[model samples]
Target: MLARQLEQFSCIRQARVQLAPQSWQSGAVIVLEPARPEAMPDAAALDRMLDTLALIPDAPDKRHVLVFDTEGRRLYPDHETDETARREQEVALERQALRVLRPLLDGNGRAEVLVSLDEAEKGRTTGRRTISVLLEENAVPETVRPHLESLLGQACALEEGRGDALRICFLPARRNAAALRGLALTFAVLALAGMAAFF
Candidate 1:
């Protein structure tokens, strides 16, 4: 819906919108590829685009929009260099976590995880490292949890945020292996019961 609205403008060739990091609650980032590289949207056009983004339910109440050209240039919040850097750093952390978690999840791209770095520990060992992994029913398989946590802890220990505690959380996303196995067992039992009754 938002993309269609943005496409109505002449300057926008295509508009791709994504929540900051990975989920909807996070702020929005709109990457715009212009119809003509030399003819970027004017300030008024940008304002209109931002307004449309702000109207989305997931958008924050403060309504700050970050626009980036295909070249990784910041188009708005021009003064918020620190904020931009912070978001980039968060994204970097997220990518690192995914590097380790993806294989464990069978390369499921739909898996959601957020890795947040504490700014105070930017270059120091005293900063906190938080890894939030979205799992089904707040459960992590006994076999997977310890190994996954160990891997993440090792990653944090090696990074700048190693001095403080390493926090790991399991948020709700898709069902994990244990849950799927239980579901399969239930189906098997029901099927056996039906066959017994028929025989």
Candidate 2:
């Protein structure tokens, strides 16, 4: 039943609509916005979208990078409280969202996550938080790109005040296991050589 719903949601014709499970709400909802023709999504919406997407069922071999627009309302909604309180809230939300999504974005899913705030609002916001995830490119199979993209797009749309000029990107996961193994072997050999010299 869930699989069929997911498929139907993915087939939605609008380019900017997205669907995903919401961690806070514990329910799936549809987010709608204009196509990528207007302004980009805000920081608050981006954060909410990531929070929602963390609940998706991802494969172990697929890698993903969830980009959040930190300058928009997608991640941090403007509040009347003092700047300190608002900033603290934003940071807390980002940390919690990352903790939940980290496992799904790592390894054969060499996910590279990034949260980018618009340059104009870089230091102006009351609550400021920056989070990034870096993983090898090409982690997930090409077949999954459409599905993931659809999910992300839907997530962006479901939020409040998401614009059409949004620019969300997903990179392919890269393989670096061989490079890591080589480095480990080199370190082991060096340690053994040093021991022999000391004796």
Question: What's the lDDT of the predicted structure labeled candidate 1?
Answer: 0.63
lDDT of 2 at 130: 36
| lDDT digits (tens) for residues 1-199 of candidate 2 | 2223222333222322122212112322223332342444454544443454445565111112122233222323333434324333433443444454454453546443333222224444321223344434454445654455344334322232322222335554443689989999999999999999999
The lDDT, on a scale of 0 to 1, for candidate 2 is 0.38
Q: What RMSD does model 2 have?
A: 17.1
Where is the poorest 10-residue window by lDDT in model 2? 59-68
Candidate 1 lDDT over residue span 1-199, tens digit each:
6666677778889987656644224566667889998767855658766776566665643244567787767675565665566665555566677677666663343455565555554465333556666654334455787687678766545454254444555555566689999999999999999999999
The whole-model lDDT of each prediction reads 0.63, 0.38
What lDDT score is found at residue 4 in candidate 2?
Answer: 34
Which residues of candidate 1, in runs, are more than 4 Å off?
1-26, 31-48, 54-58, 61-63, 68-80, 107-109, 118-127, 136-144, 154-199
* Per-residue lDDT of 102 in model 1: 64
